[model samples]
Target: MSKILDAFLNENLEALRDQGLYNEIDAVEGANGPIIQVNGKKLINLSSNNYLGLATNEELKQVAKKAIDEYGVGAGAVRTINGTMDLHVKLEEKLAEFKGTEAAISYQSGFNCNMAAISAVMDKNDAILSDQLNHASIIDGCRLSKAKIIAYKHSDMDDLRTKAKEAKESGLYNKIMVITDGVFSMDGDIAKLPEIVEIAKEFDLITYVDDAHGSGVTGKGKGTVKHFGLEKEIDFQIGTLSKAIGVVGGYVAGKKNLIDWLKVRSRPFLFSTAVTPGDVAAITRAVEMIMESTELHDRLWENGDYLKAGLKKLGFEIGASETPITPCIIGDEKLTQQFSKRLVEEGVYAKAIVFPTVPKGTGRVRNMPTAAHTKEMLDDALAIYEKVGRELGVIN
Candidate 1:
């Protein structure tokens, strides 16, 4: 409608295409699982975040259907209004238990949880010491808080300590918070939470951890805080119900006072409609399963190890990944995109990560091996990787 708006959008879109940065979304034809059908082609999927492969679990699906039958499709109103149902309450209780916290509060999504919780607690009077490589959601959350943000070297405890000391001694803010991702998704490295906790204790800083990628994958499905046995020490533990839990929504687990504060002050929770009853039920069931057994978690790691071993054997430069997330590094961005395209053509579906998402010249095809993937599926995916890597001169 507006010519200036049109021109601005067109110019930016063309620039993205010209730079080979435009992402083309692929439509999945059926359930997203170990194997997915994309554009009429069946491929071994290594691009999904369904860590434990519970996204398509039959039991969870059944529970969701039952919930739908009892409570309908939607929650009907905002959480502060009439939307907080029995299922919602139960999910929060289950999340607190799972995360080993005194209380928990849920939101529509993980992104919203970060955006809501961070700003609600920290404000202009505070300073946030964040990890350089933390998730974009954390960055946006900090900005929204209007706090002085000081970024430290990624996972470098020394840098964190230095920044913390400076911020505290300056007396520029009333409160200081240190936030980091429990597991750095891109490199698949676990954060040094123990060292961070020690630093926080020394400075009396409020500690926050976004463990969206760690829940159900670490700490025997409890999460990274439990992984390091610092459940009571950390103040905020944010997680998603969508990733390993295989549903929708996010939550912040902490003390009862913090949870109560979020319930009243978090704008998203107060104004937005609550998560669907089916999703809440499914997520609760999924967490129950994770706590009940460690079978899925073990299978996920086994598959990750098998795939990593195969890629290394084929001479591909798989980067330093301590978790199930693997990255086949291809230094050039265009070539990295081409490598991912070739993988898709050969019956594997892994996506490329380039600048903005990752540093320039470190473009990579990130693979996420799930618990549902059988050895045969992984072997086939490995074969495709080797073929593509060798053909593209990415490997010997």
Candidate 2:
């Protein structure tokens, strides 16, 4: 309530509003499924990261309900303090099996996973070669480690190789790590993990991949590491249970030693309360479902393709997205926000992404078509897009 603090907040907030950079949050009326209700208006949702539609799967819901009856809702305390639960242990084991790793350790969320794991293994004496478009969590994690961060051009293998070679040859650090997102969320592009793995081997750099947007949506639902068969080559496989897995937590899958070290040293795991018993149970079941069948994953990709094709055919500047995440690029910030608003007004809830989430002047309305979306739903969305696109002059 100090005058200085009030002035600082007022000035920055006004600046953001003037520049069309301030985000307005909307509340979903019920579940965040394929169709959502906002302010009592039902709409086809295209902005969720729930890739495989597992978030609303009936079987998973039943599993969580059963778990709550048996184990209660909360886990009581941190894993180290109150001891780990059986569900927690089972989820970790399933995660390791799913990722084809020797062991795995869980965290409160995907963002916390990166923040904990990176700083635990690397320190001031180490250096990290990070991709330019990695998630904000990875960037913060590298900073937390106090390591010298060398950013390469986004998915530019040549730039990565040059940086890796220079960092290695300089002998300026004890350990060098290369980190990237398995899938760039904004562009929906898959990272070149094969090339990155090759470069890592040549430079003896420790490899870390944050596949938050890839799991349960790629590699028949195993992930990008498995998509490229780099299970053993990549040193760290980081992911979230919240997205495709449809739960609430994050994890790192790797060698037994790495898991052991993280269990002891990762601050989040050591300090934060363990995932709720119900969530842990449901996460284990979700991973099992992904391992047992690829029906959801296949349907997700089909929806993605259908949506992307429709957007492109309408003359919208859909970006180069390799996965199911589709982005309709609108260069001007205000216009992009207006486009998103129009889509929402027309009953399609595709949100505008701008500023720090991506770069200025490259605003977009990102769409994520999940497995739960039927052809009829998609057709309706496309029709809405056409109307909005024509109205906004985004497409002919």
Candidate 3:
């Protein structure tokens, strides 16, 4: 390593440490589920994004193993080459059906899908009206698209309408697209897709909803677009197979032409290796399971409600969450980190979200309660929370 590069890394890392913003990653010793083991301690995990808890489902695991046995481990080459397997086709078909779109295309990850899809369609001449609170992937994707990115206020329909009208009337661009997260991960608030769709209709703007957290948890497991019954209204519906689907991949479901365009133009799809056969098989089975039953969906909501009510009852300020994601709002960043540390020590695993993730001062401990979490597990987590809150003087 060059001495100059080492010096630069040392300086930035020290700066991060000084600001208490350096994240220390803890490895989960075993399978990530409702509960997980870290640093030799088994804790009731509330930080995982395993919404439907299908990540460790026996059936899905069996399917993945079986696929591995038949097809081996990797896709050998990029999709444009000889890597497009039958499993990939089936996965895309199922995703299209799940999102109620004409076609769908999968990527290696949700972030990859965003980076590939957005830039593939939109370009420098176009202007994108993006939600201020959209996911980082969406933000990065928009930036990569080279579009004139105009950020509208978070979930503010009036602001979106104003921006949309301006972008349309400006006549400086060939197209205008409105992109937002179907569910904002930090606050767990669902996007106002109905209002957004209306604005899109009036402005003739393309609509994109990244329903990463909404799928398998909302709309009887269909998603936020389907939740609001505007599946056909949105132009691009992006989803993750990793989160609720309990697999690993991302997809963009939309009209056939759009899908065709992405298949040829998306750089990631053209150059990157395709998703593994096991993941494809597992994700396909997971989507099929979601479409077939509401059992997991209902259970996830129940657990979310149960945990939210408990947190609220304990006098902790749980923010406005329309979904199972819960945030225990503690303003001071240091205090928030300390609070999470205490929870982990006390046998609960909730992660702290501070500056740059949310705003600087609105530091919070975000909890993700899944269908896999038993009531007993939630109750124990609540008790731990109560203790930590009192110790930290957050609750009365």
Model 2: per-residue lDDT, tens digit, 133-167? 99999999999999999999999999999989999
Question: For model 3, how does the per-residue alpha-carbon lDDT over 1-396 read when each residue is reduced to its tens digit?
Answer: 999999999999998667667777999999999889999999999999999999999999999999999998999999999999999999999999999999999999999989999999999999999999999999999999999999999999999999888889989999999999999999999999999999999999999999999999889899999999998899999999899998888999999999999999999899999999999999999999999999999999999999999999999998899999999999988888889999999999999998789988898999999999999999999999999899889998
The C-alpha stretches of model 1 lying farther than 4 A from their native spots are none
Off by over 4 Å in 2: none
Cα deviation in Å at residue 48, candidate 3? 0.6
lDDT of each prediction vs. the true structure?
Answer: 0.93, 0.94, 0.94
- TM-score of every candidate: 0.99, 0.99, 0.98
Model 1, global lDDT:
0.93
C-alpha positional error of residue 280 in candidate 3 after TM-score superposition, expressed in Å:
0.5
Candidate 3 wrongly placed segments (more than 4 Å): none
Least lDDT summed over 10 consecutive residues: which range in candidate 2? 81-90
| Ordered list by TM-score, greatest first | 2, 1, 3
Residue-level lDDT tens digits of model 1 in 1-396 = 799999999999998777667778999999999999998999999999999989999999999999999999999999888999999999899989999999999999999989999999999999999999999999999999999999999999999999999999998999999999998899899999999999999999999999999999989889999999999999999999889998888999999999999999999999999899999999999999999999999999999999999998999888788889899988888898899999999999999888889987898899999999999999999988888988999988
lDDT of 1 at 322: 84
Residue 341 Cα positional deviation in candidate 2, in Å, after optimal superposition = 0.6
RMSD of each: 0.8, 0.7, 0.9
